[model samples]
Target: MIRIAVIGQSGSIPEEVERMAEEAGAEVARRGAVLLTGGGSGVMEHASKGAKEAGGLVIGILAGDRTDVANDYLDVPITTGLGFDFRSLILVHSCDALIMIRGGNGTLGELSAAYMNCKPTVAIETSGGWAEKVKQTAFEGCYLDERRTVEIHYAHSGKLAVDRAFELLASKWNEERNTGVTGD
Candidate 1:
């Protein structure tokens, strides 16, 4: 099972973008994939709601120990006591791949962390926010850094973005297995 984290804005997102995020989550669930999120509001809420409705497991990597703020749709809530900044790192580390929707600074931080850790990430570019900024800010269109640690793939729709994510993940795991252990 692939641990797919959904990174996006919390607290009141645009109506259309929120719907896109929900559709993304429903697609994730329908495909039998795990849905992970920061677990607040807006996009996260919609995603979790979609996943739950689709009978998929939803995990929330929350900023604090309190589960009260977490969406009702979550199957499990990881109460990361590290606050927002540090908890974001946990979200990146825990996932095999990530799907980014319309996001803010917090989502951007996760994107950077995913790049640093070589985790494959797919962005729904049509959603806006960091999804739009990343194409311009990335080191070489796709790469987040000059090291070529991980390159972000862009898709026009949530479904396509998820598809790209899985493809990248399979390719990445294959490379990791073939490369084996390296000293230098």
Candidate 2:
């Protein structure tokens, strides 16, 4: 199954953004994909709630070696003792794609990691924070750098973002298959 990580802000966020995150998670679940998150509050919690409600598997790549700080919606909490930054990298590396909602510095770092790892990512453009800002700040409004390893797609809604992410994954897989280059 494809694992799609929802990268976004933690703690106090706009209601609209929370809705978007939840919708994205629900969409991911409905599509039979596992939902991954940082397992904290705000976007992560909201998304996890949606996924759980939709009967989807929710995994949290949590910081530290305890699940006390993780959201209540997680089905599996991976307590990584590697701290926040390292745990974020684990979240990025473990996913096939990512959906970005309203995010701050942590989300931005995840975006950068996704780009570096050539993972497909779709950002909700209207969700604010890095999700909105990166569209203007990124090179050619998509790539993170001159390398252009992967194009960051922007969507107006959570469902659209998840759809776009699946499309991107399909395209990438097709391209790899056509080129006879297994992305192993």
Best by lDDT: 2
Q: 1-184 in candidate 2: lDDT tens per residue?
A: 9999999999999999989999999999999999999999999999999999999999999999998989999999999899999999999999999999989999999999999998899999999999999999999999999988889999999899999999989988998899999764
TM-score of each: 0.94, 0.98
- List per-prediction Cα lDDT, in the order shown: 0.87, 0.94
Tens digit of lDDT per residue, candidate 1, span 25-143? 88889889999998889889998888888899999999999999998989999998999999999999988889999899989999999888878888988888998889988888888
RMSD vs true structure, all candidates: 2.2, 0.7
Off by over 4 Å in 2: none
Maximum-TM-score candidate: 2
RMSD value for candidate 1: 2.2
* After superposition, candidate 1 runs with Cα above 4 Å error: 181-184
Candidate 2, residue 168: how far the Cα is off, in Å: 0.5
